[model samples]
Target: GNATMGSGVDKHALERSSYEVLTGAADIRDAITKAEQAGYDLLPANADLTAAEVELLQMPQRERRLREALNSINGRYDYILIDCPPSLNMLTLNALVAAQSVIIPMQCEYYALEGLTALVSTIEDVRDNLNPFLKIEGLLRTMYDPRNRLAGDVTAQLSKHFGDKLYRTVIPRNIRLAEAPSHGQPALVYDKASRGAKAYLALAGEMLRREEMASAGA
Candidate 1:
C-alpha cells in the first residue's frame, strides 16, 4: 500500500473545522494518525508550523526537518505525497527535499503558467542542491473549461514544453468537484459516476500506468 500524502493543502474559504486542522497544530516529528475511515493514515499540521520558519532558522539542517520527521515512519508507507502551498517557503522546501518526485496539478490559466515557470526553477535549484533525485512526475491540467479559448492556449503552451510530462487526463470544472470537499468526502466516494470523479479515476489510472511503464523500462 502506498501511503501517499498531500501536505499544506488548505481551502480558500475554510470551514471552522478546516481552519482548525491547518492551524489546529500537531507535533511534527512524530504525530501520525489515520484520518476518518479513509483507510490512509494522516499527519497532523498546525498553524504554529508557520513559526517554524524563525524557530528553525537557527537550527542545523532546518531544510530537512520534515524529511527527518517522515523518515522515522518511512517503513509504514510505499508512497507519500506532499501537497505544498502555492508559494515557495521553508515548508515547501522541506517537502521537495523529502520527495523523490512531484505531481503538479495546474489550472489552465495564463497566471498558472507563470507560476509553473517559477516552480520549475525552484525544483531545479532544489534538485541540484538539496535533493539530487527530485523529479517532476507529471503536470496535470485541472479545472479545465474547454469552452475557454485562453485555457486551451495555455494548455497548448504547456504541452509544447512538457510534452509527455503533461498528463492526458484533464479535470474539468464541475460543481461536484467543489461540493465533495464541503461534504467531507472524495468525489469518487460522493458520486462515483460524476464527471469529476471519473476524471480523477482516469488520472489515477494514468499515473499507475506510467509507473508500470517506467518500472518495466528500468
Candidate 2:
C-alpha cells in the first residue's frame, strides 16, 4: 500500500515467489488470486477472526483460527512477517496480539522523538492489557543522514534509551530508494548496487541475527 501510495517502492519489485497476505482486502479470494498471479500467497480473513476481535485469544473460534494460521506455517516458510499499518486502529491491535515481537522503524531526526513517547506508552499498555508475551523486535534507524548534527544527537539519545535494541545497521537517505517504488520494485531489485539496497540487506541480516538470538533464548 505504501508503494501504491507512491513512496517510491514499486509493487512488482518484491521477490517473484514472495507471498502477499492481504488482511484488508475487500474480497479475500480475489486478492489472493491476484497475488498468486504475482507469485504471492494471500491470506484470507474469516469473519470471526477479524481485526475487530480484540480479545482474539479469549474467543474460542478466533483463537483457533489464529493458532491454525500460525501453526500451518511452522515449517512451510522460514518466516511469517506481518506488515502492520501505522495507526492505533483495530488492525494494529490484532497485529500486536498476533506478533510476539515488534520492530520500530524510525528516522533519527529531532522530530522523530515526538511520537516515540506515545508509541512506547501504547506498547506498554498493549503488553499490560492484551499480549503479555510481546516484546520489541528492534529499533531500526532509517533514512539517516550521518552528517546532520540533529540526527547524530537523536541517534545517541535513542541508543542510550534503547541500548541493545537499537540495530547496528543504519539506513541512509538515498535518492534511489525514493525512486524505486515508482517502478513497483524493492530497492534491492531496482538498484542492487545502491547504498539503500546494501543497507536494507544489512538490516535483513541484523534482523535474522536478532531472531536467532530470540529463538535460542526461547
Candidate 3:
C-alpha cells in the first residue's frame, strides 16, 4: 500500500515501514513481511506513513523514491502491486513512477468515470515527464451488479471507450468479499465458493490467457 494510507487492518509489524524506506531511514527489505495465508510477501504500512507525504516534499528525487527502493529487489517477484490511495498525491506520484503498468479498478458509476478522466490525464503526464514506459495494462470494473441499469450503461460506455483494454471479468458485489478483509483473510481463503472468490479466480485466468496470447504474438 501507498505510504499515505492505511489498510485499516494490520497485517504485520515491521522494524521499518514504507515511511522509513521512503525517507532513507531503513532498508526496503526490512519492511517486507511474508504473508503465508495470502501467499505473497507484503510491504505493510501503518499510521506513521501519513507523515511521509509531507516529508517527501523536502527530500531529493522525491518522486523516484519508490522506484529506487524496488530496484534493489528487482526480479525477485513476478509482480509488485502497489495499492495506492484514492486521491492523487506525492505518494501516488511515487507509485506511478515505480510501476511499469497500471491496472485501474473502478466502480461503474458516473463519479467514477469523472475520476477516471483525471486519473488518465495524470498517467499521461507522468508518462511524458517522469516514466516514459508507464502504460495502462487494463481497466477492471469492480463491485459490479448485473441487475443495476446504471451499471450496465456505464459498462457499455467503458467498452466503447476502452475496447479490449477493459477486462472481460467484472468483480461482482459480494458480501463475503467485504467481510474477508475484516477477518484478515482473502475471500478465496475465507470462502472459495463465494461469488467474489470465483470472480477473482476467473480474472486471474483471463489475465494469464492474455499474457500468453501477447507472448505468442510477440
Top-lDDT structure, candidate number: 3
What lDDT does each candidate get? 0.73, 0.64, 0.87
- Report the poorest 10 consecutive residues by lDDT, candidate 3: 2-11
- Model 1 pairs in collision: 5-81, 6-83, 7-83, 23-47, 25-46
Q: Could you tell me the C-alpha RMSD of candidate 1 in Å?
A: 5.3
lDDT of 3 by residue, 1-218 (tens): 32211233363455667889999998888878766676777787877777999999999999999999999999999888898888899999999999999999999999999999999999999999999999999999999999999999999999998899999999999999888777767677888999999999999999899889999999
Cα lDDT tens digits, model 1, 120-192, are: 9999999999999999999999999999999889888988999999999999998987877666565666688
In terms of lDDT, model 1 sits at 0.73
Candidate 2: misplaced stretches above 4 Å? 3-75, 214-218
TM-score of 3: 0.94
On lDDT, the stronger of 2 and 3 is: 3
TM-score of 2: 0.71
| CA RMSD of each candidate after superposition | 5.3, 6.3, 2.4
Across 7-104, the per-residue lDDT of candidate 2 in tens digits comes to 33234443221122222213323332233222334343233333344544445544233333455456655555566656765556656776778888
